[model samples]
Target: MLKTGSHIQINDTTLRDGEQAPGVVFTLAEKVAIARELAAAGVDEIEAGTPAMGDEEVEGIAAVVSQNFCTRVTAWCRLSETDVDAALRAGVKHVNISAPMSRLQMRVKLKAEPDEVAARVTRVIGYAREKGLEVALGGEDSSRADLRDIGLIAGAAAKLGVFRFRFADTLGLLDPFSTYEYIKRLRDETDLPIEFHGHNDLGLATANTLAAIRAGASAASVTVLGLGERAGNAPLEEVAVALPRTADARTGVDPTRLMELCDLVAKASRDSIPRAKPIVGADIFTHESGIHVAGLLHDVRTYQGLDPAMLGRRHKVVIGKHSGLAAVRSVCAAVGLDLDNSVAARVLARVKNIAKTTKTLVPDARVRSVARQELEGAETRDMAPARAELRLHP
Candidate 1:
């Protein structure tokens, strides 16, 4: 939903660039399923795959095109006739044709002069337009490219009727503050629709993406669960959850299914989502601290920003050293622990010692086990030990 004047659209690349994550491959069936999910999640577009790859790649784009799930599917390609022919053969009507606008990509990769590549882009855009396919011009290494020359390349694409000009931090080296400044200047210079594509080598993709939107980016490229080559790209779920709540802009991502989508990316990608990942992590809503559990029992808002119920999650009170007496009582109430003052004291002492020794949060099952062992110790000894003991049962 557009609120007033928010500038944000999602061009998800989970199936395309995200699959480029080393050692991760998505089968045809897997790619189609993810494309459908991305469509269902309200993303504006999907960068399906590179058509120039092979028949398998072409078939994948066709599979997504066949579904036609209200998402525009585009292919990434060089600004060359061969790549354009492959894209057309794959039946994808939209393509992001690009070249090295930077001295790095142009000089090193293309090994062509600046003026030479710029004219080549214009010619290819005209060719794609003639083929009746919509186009987005990609400035491959704009982060390191001269800003004035970048604008000139973009203006050339604009002159050829390309509206979306994607500025890529191909090396994942740009910071959030610098990203905003450059993108802000870019928007002022051209009327083209700006899309920010960031990488996570510096672990700043999501942060920089947000800054880009705040500065006037039309869309931000993202992947599910932050899956991409090397350090991966900005996470689609994180960008969705953070932007609307944190920025003047908003995107159309389903907040409730954010975790479910994270799970989907993890399972399909065969990578485990971290337990502390924001918004959708396994432990994000699971409270193990005694103090936190106590506060949560009174009101979940005391411990969580968004309600667990909203994400179809239940709040769990686990026994840990950081937990207070109220949390202990709550977990016991949930699990029928029913401990008296003496038993509670023994359990609390055991929790403290365990956390201190392990240097980590104590788990609930361990607390319950310790309580049982303490009962056994008292029963066996007939009297409490003269000194304290924090012993493990197993």
Candidate 2:
């Protein structure tokens, strides 16, 4: 179990791995702006970009590095000196030197034995440290690698002054149970700070990431909106909010400003935010069901699992086919109209009919019109008895 008050660090890779999303490209200004926002949101680190992509990419990374953000800025590099040289040109003080750790990756991709991969790790990491750059080692596909080999590779890197070891779920294959066990086993092997970099192929990245933290990983890799190659990486917003709630861990990321940051990334990446996306979606805090609305009207806690107030937002009740009298009254009152129980019932009927016909929620004007008609009918019926009594008495 994760100890309370343990500080969990967020290493945001939106610019590096996130931009790897197909057809997604961020200009230099966009990169710098994102890094600035991440820093302001109290991200512990920013993975600026892969400088080995060439000079244009290097220049962009340099622009971000120039800001000298409060958060540490790092570049991603493969197990090659050329990659490290490119990062050096970009003016970053930190680098994550990655090497394939799995035997399959070693045989198919590198065409080398484990010893050769180990040799490359030592050389690249040593060069990075000699260049006066802080280093972290990424064990690519560590989830599939042999545990004994991971211990050997990571132990070597740790002895050579590497500060952290990143265990990446490169294929997004591991579930929460395996994730916990993976990190737990690795934790017993090395004292180096472990970071979990999870993918979302099975839509379990957030859960797996939290599990890693619970298993003693100190950091997590995240993107602004789970943006990455294939499905995506773990979403920053989900993990940030989930940490404090699930593990009693704090990331120092302001949950209230998370939506703003997500919007900025969405606009820059041209990736639309899903209406139902957790933590930063357009409709997560909206309610429409009659039962839920009634319960919320009586006590907000009844229907609320996570407080919207924490994100600088409030819960909203929208009228639809599932709406009830309580919801109709709540909507009417917002528009400066009071609906009695009978009138509210009538308006709710209209709301459901309109919603069914349109296949959407009813608007305020339509609901108000229904309530006006109901009130008018009530007044007409009330006057009929008085008028008849006056005529008979006269």
Candidate 3:
């Protein structure tokens, strides 16, 4: 487990990896805007873009760099001198130089053996350092690579004074157990700061990332909404919020601004935020179930795990098929209606019927109307009993 108060660095790759999601693109203005928001949200670094993508990408990266935000802005680059040159042109002081780590990638992508791959990575790290670029070496497909080979390359990069070694679960194939073991073994390899870059193909990126951190990785590479190639990468919001709670660690991220930042990215990418998405989801704090709403009414802690107020939001109670009398009364009271027990029960019945028919939450307006009708009927019934008693007395 991570030590208490361990500060995990958040390296957000929203502009680079996030935009790589199929059919997703960000305009220059949007890129700057996102970088601004990311800095304001207290990310430790922003992977602006891959400078090697060409002038357009370089310009985009440069635009973010020109903003001079306090957060470090870094460029992604392949393990080549040409890529490093592109990064310099983009005016970024830091660069993450990537190399194929798995034997399959080395044989197919680089067409080399272990010795040749190690030589190439060392040469690039030296060249980048000579060019005055702060460097982090990224091990592509590290999950499939042998631990010895990872140590070899990272150990070599360390000699040249690289700042960190990024172990990427490039295919998102590792579970939390495997992730912890891999990172733990890698820790014995080199003294370089270890950063974990995880993918979501297995839907375990966040879990794997946490495991890696517990095993001694100091940094997490993430993107907004988990947006990336294939399934996506580890989500920034999930990792940031979960670190303190689950790992006894903390990040610089502000949970309160996460929703706004996520909404901004979702809109720019033309992707709708899933209403049930964790952390920033619209319905994450919305309650409609009978048991849950009753529990919340009695004591919020009964149904509460993550506090919505931490994200600058509150719990919302809506009447639906699963709603109980407590939820109905709460909804009615919100609209300036007072429902006695009898009226509340009648309104809840109507709500369930309406919700069943519509296959949706019963609107507050409709609930108010039903409450009014029930109240009028109850009043008429009460007056009749008094009138009969008076007639008998006369």
Best-fitting candidate, scored by lDDT: 3
The better-scoring model by lDDT among 2 and 3 is 3
lDDT of 2 by residue, 197-295 (tens): 998999999999999999999999999999988989999999999998888899989988898899999999888899999999889999999999999
Off by over 4 Å in 1: 1-7, 17-19, 335-342, 351-394
Which pairs, if any, clash in model 2?
A: none
Candidate 3: C-alpha RMSD after superposition: 2.8
Give candidate 3's whole-model lDDT: 0.92
Clashing pairs in 1: 289-323, 290-322, 290-323, 290-324, 291-323, 291-324
Q: For residues 282-354, what per-residue lDDT tens digits would candidate 1 score against the true structure?
A: 8887887666676777777887887768667876666556767676655565677777778778778878888
TM-score of each: 0.88, 0.96, 0.96
Per model, how many backbone clashes are there? 6, 0, 0
Full-model lDDT, candidate 1: 0.81
Give the range of the ten consecutive residues with the poorest summed lDDT in model 2: 385-394
**Residue 219 alpha-carbon offset, candidate 2, angstroms:** 0.2
